[model samples]
Target: MSNDKIKEDLPAILERYRDRIEATIKPYLSLNLTPDENLTWWQSKFAGREKSPGGFPYLPKGFDYPQTSDGEYLLLLAQINFAEVPYLEGFPTRGILQFYIADNDSYGFSNYYCELNYPQSNWRVIYFPEPDLNAENLITDFDFLPEKYWFETTELEITKCSAIRWTKKYAPICLEDDSAYKLLLPQIGEAVPFELEDLYEEFTDAYLKILDNDGWFCPLQMGGYSCYFSDDPRVGFSEEEDPFDTLLLKISLIESGSLFFYIQSSALAKCDFSKVLYAMA
Candidate 1:
């Protein structure tokens, strides 16, 4: 069905489970930037430093670019200057954060026993708490990167850059996961009659279908409920056990896949990306 049709039917979905789903609502910053093949790397930086999907990240003088375990340079997946982003809880008010992934076929996702392994060797999340704004001090030469890695996998080229405009919006849970439902059950139960006990699956499916169809779920966002194309990373953990409370970033990949970075609130506050969990779906 078309997005207009789904949007027209959204009211019905909301009215049916208004109380239950309302509690799941959380705000997120929507990144509005379209990748243009014609735009040169210099043109992307014309708007000054900003958030981008794939770009030459802001590298200070002394900092070495992130590399995989094999010592190959990781490609920039996203660069987020928190100064350009709105204030989000548990998120830095100022800093330049970058997500780098391997240029390999797997996009640097390393798995163990068919499950995502922690302390990922192929991907990296670097935080520059105090970004030096001097352009001359940054590394300008990026010709060393392999040319094949620049191709656009989706609409966005992995190597080209596009400046981002932030739009703060509200979102509810998109994917269905038992752990997530259980975690929010208490709050949802308090608002209504615990109707989700019988209608959780049915309601969630219908609601998410509308949201997804209408493009309400962001392919790249910050500090919001994660909308995965496949499985949610924190699906197995219990309510009391917090695997990850912060959705650091989510980047869409080819074939409806996504790369996610999750971190604890405390760790994020400390500007520590060491313990952040990397997941691909």
Candidate 2:
């Protein structure tokens, strides 16, 4: 990668590639989560019906808490109550979706690279098509957790129960994905009056800059395109071979990078989470 800063005429570039850019656009939900400072672990155990991340989970009575092969409890990464979300086509109108990952160094992803068939024991996605809305009937005791789900700072223990606020957005396919270059370059070449061979890198860099400037680079999103720090997991597979078609959920963590959950369209429509795929990068 070049260290030298490259700038382009952004307006001209946007006008040139407007059609290609528009074609890649898709709708997504941006998760805005705020933690409640006053919330205690005890309160979280009460299992209120809400969308959150990294707090106590909402479990139905008698529901088995997900665990690893060694019987270690998996931690809640995110819990999405679709009923709280704005409606999106092909997504469940009303349901509770929870993502759990083994509380380990790799966060349940043991592989150095992304792959398929990640053991459910390591990571799991649970969907309750008809979720129990009553908090009283939900599991309320989480004393089994090894430690309080809050971190102890030098000052004091800060307990949190994050509350999610969903904002619907139209996100274009990420230009960073290698496949975007393959798909859009030909379209650009035909549309633009000037040759793009020499200006490819400059154009791509500027496009990213424009996206960032416009505040389209969301770290945590549902649906739309998949974002990555390394390789796109769907790279090797052809369209026919790729079963995981939808980016169900994506949570970006600074410590372990990003967690991506994908599901097949058919599976998502039928509310089958058994075939959901997990990948961390």
Candidate 3:
């Protein structure tokens, strides 16, 4: 198959099979997960159970008590040994779907971790705190557009070679070319005029230190900038550092943006502040 065709077919196949996979696993776990809530809900449930002194005793059939490691534990449940799971009908290979659950409650420890692996080809890992609200409701409430979902098209203006045109048109500047900009504009626009004043009061010392270090414009440019692993000759990765750690940090930033946009979009869509605050602490 062509690469493009494979790319197109893969997501469709994954989406089609995702529900069947969740359905098979859900009956064997303590949590009830909707299609949208599957990853986060399962991660939270497993993490909570793993961290507790006694693991969750209420798991359904075919699941075993998780095995504890050095400040972590992993639970391996049912596998797709055959075409028994309805979704595996046409897939060439049918093998294990391992569920790894882990947690650590100590300071600076990773609070939660969950992984769903399909042999070697595809794997997904999620980490987060326990859900304060219903898993389904939390997923629904936080359904904001992903960060990479943006419109990018360049428009060229042409005029007669020797002629100058002075047609007046106004277009608002967009900070991020994504749907969140549209949803956040009303509030952020209102706050823009007062942003400098607010910053002066809220971050006087840090702002001054930034000015001293990198000058006035640096603070504005720094907001959109992110540190990412570079394979480019300049600022390349080091032998000592882990590439996976860099990727995880990058994913964490994306998740942070998604959560922030969801919360700021509406009071109703806001995540439970206590859980977030406690997690940070």
Candidate 4:
């Protein structure tokens, strides 16, 4: 199909979800953002954001973050005891986002990753990674741009216009309704799983490469406490044939980072998560 044809078709899927999402998914969907629900407020309890004095949507001095994304709660996350994979409450997997949201602050749209906790009354925001917007970065800002299209943006007007266009076209998928919403995941990459030792090795490599310049290249992050199948290393399952039979290594992550771990593949499969997440009771 033509690029224009592809773009045109994408919106219809988005439209269907918006029309019926609120009505069908009564429990998870929210039209308004609340302190109890939105991460901008909840995240304040943990590590605070670094804020500037006056800027787009300005806030007071010493203020860690901008005002709440009150009207912009994008998704509510929760996981079954054993939702899709057996690597419960580990890296890459948080919970399930009821949908998506493109909410951001002056820097850019901040996508919040939340998990449903006990009492089930509120969501625990694991972390939120803000956009790192530098002129150099925008050159590859494909998230906002439509596929099959690209152009240089040395001019400010051309740049602003592109961001506006990308947001409009790309951010609508999160508001999708039930049936059509099922298709959104497959469009993402496949989930690829890895072992803890392997992950640590990769992390060490990245940490060293960027240590001088202060960088971490490893993209995988783990949550929850680590577990082992047995005391013996030989009996443990790191790359077992069965996805469920493997022992889990829980690693704490820098909550501020945007790293993401995946299942066997980062690609989204039908009715399954790409990130193998494990949660505890």
lDDT of each: 0.60, 0.63, 0.21, 0.23
Q: C-alpha displacement of 258 in model 3, angstroms?
A: 9.8
* Count of backbone collisions in candidate 4: 28
Q: After superposition, how far is residue 164 of candidate 4 from its true place, in Å?
A: 16
Highest TM-score: give the candidate number: 2
The TM-scores, one per candidate, come to 0.73, 0.76, 0.19, 0.18
The TM-score of candidate 3 is: 0.19
* TM-score between model 1 and native: 0.73
Better of 2 and 4 by lDDT: 2
Model 4 bad stretches (over 4 Å): 1-236, 242-262, 279-281
lDDT by residue (tens digit), candidate 1, 73-152: 87676667777777777788887777777776776766531123456567777777877766688776767665434224
TM-score ranking, best first: 2, 1, 3, 4
At residue 125, give the lDDT of candidate 1: 75
Name model 2 segments beyond 4 Å from true: 1-10, 37-54, 113-115, 148-159, 187-196, 213-216, 237-240
RMSD of 1: 6.4
Better of 2 and 4 by TM-score: 2
Q: Which residue segments of model 3 deviate by more than 4 Å?
A: 1-66, 70-92, 103-281
Local error of candidate 2 at residue 100 (angstroms): 0.4
Clashes found in each candidate (C-alpha, N, C closer than 3 A): 0, 0, 0, 28
- Candidate 3: RMSD to truth: 23.8
Question: lDDT tens digits, residues 204-240, model 4?
Answer: 3432332211011111112211222222122222454
Which parts of model 1 have CA positions greater than 4 angstroms off? 1-20, 34-54, 112-120, 148-159, 175-178, 183-202, 205-216, 236-241
